[model samples]
Target: MAEGFLRHLAGDRFDVASAGTDPVGLNPGAVEAMKEVGVDIARQESKKVDRFLGQRFDYVITVCDRAKEACPTFPWAQSLLHWSFDDPAAAEGRAEERRAVFRRVRDEIAQRIRRFMARERKANKDPAQ
Candidate 1:
C-alpha cells in the first residue's frame, strides 16, 4: 500500500518498492482497496526483503512492527523510518468488514506518504527543511 501510494503520488522523483521478511502473497482486500483510490497494485509482486538486501534506497521504510524488526539496516540508505499499522489481513469479521480494514489501512498509508513527500518537497526547496 505504501509503495503503491507513494508511486501514485511521486513516482517521478522516487523509486518505491514493497517487500517483507516473510511475504504471504498480495491480499485481495489490499488490491481492492488500492483500486478504490485508482492505484492498481494487482501486478505488484510480493517480494522478500532478501531481493533488496544490497540495493540502495534514498529512504528505507518499514510499515509494520514485524517488518520493522525484520527489516535490516540499509547501510546504503540516507535515512530510515518506521510506520506501524495493523495488518488488515488479521481483521476477523465479515468480508465487508475485512475489506473495510484494508481500505482504512490504505488511506492511512496514502496520508503518511503525502506527509513524507511534502516534507521532502520542502526540504528540496529550503535545504534546511
Candidate 2:
C-alpha cells in the first residue's frame, strides 16, 4: 500500500520506493485491497533493499518490525524511519479474515504516507534554522 500511496502522490515532491529485507513477491491480498481503493499494485514487484544501497536517499522507512530489526544501514540516507506494521501475510483464521487484515494494513500505510508527505512538504518549505 506504500506503493499505492506513492502512486497517488506521484509527480509531486516525493520520490518513493519500497523494498523488503527478504524480497518476497507482492501479496495478493494487498493487491486486492489496493484495487478497492483505486490503486493498482498488481504489477509492482518486490525489491531487495540491497538494490538501493549504492544510491542515495533522503529517508529510508521500514513498515514492519521484522524489517526494522534487520534493516541494513544505508550509507547516504539522511534518516531512517521505523513505522512498524503488522505482517498481514502472517495473519491467521479464515480467508476473509486474512483479507481484512491486509485491507487494514493497506489503509494504515496509506494514511501514514499521507501524513509523512504533508510533513515532508512543510519541512522542505522551511528547513530548520
Q: CA RMSD for every model?
A: 2.5, 3.1
Estimated TM-score per prediction? 0.93, 0.90
**Candidate 1 overall lDDT versus native:** 0.87
Write out the backbone clash pairs for model 1: none
Question: What TM-score number comes out for model 1?
Answer: 0.93
lDDT of 1 by residue, 1-129 (tens): 887888888866877788989898998889999998899988888999988888888889988997898677789888998888998888999999898899899888888989998899888894533
Name the candidate that leads on lDDT: 1
Model 1 error, position 127 (Å): 12
The parts of candidate 1 lying over 4 Å away from their true place are 126-129
Highest TM-score: which candidate? 1
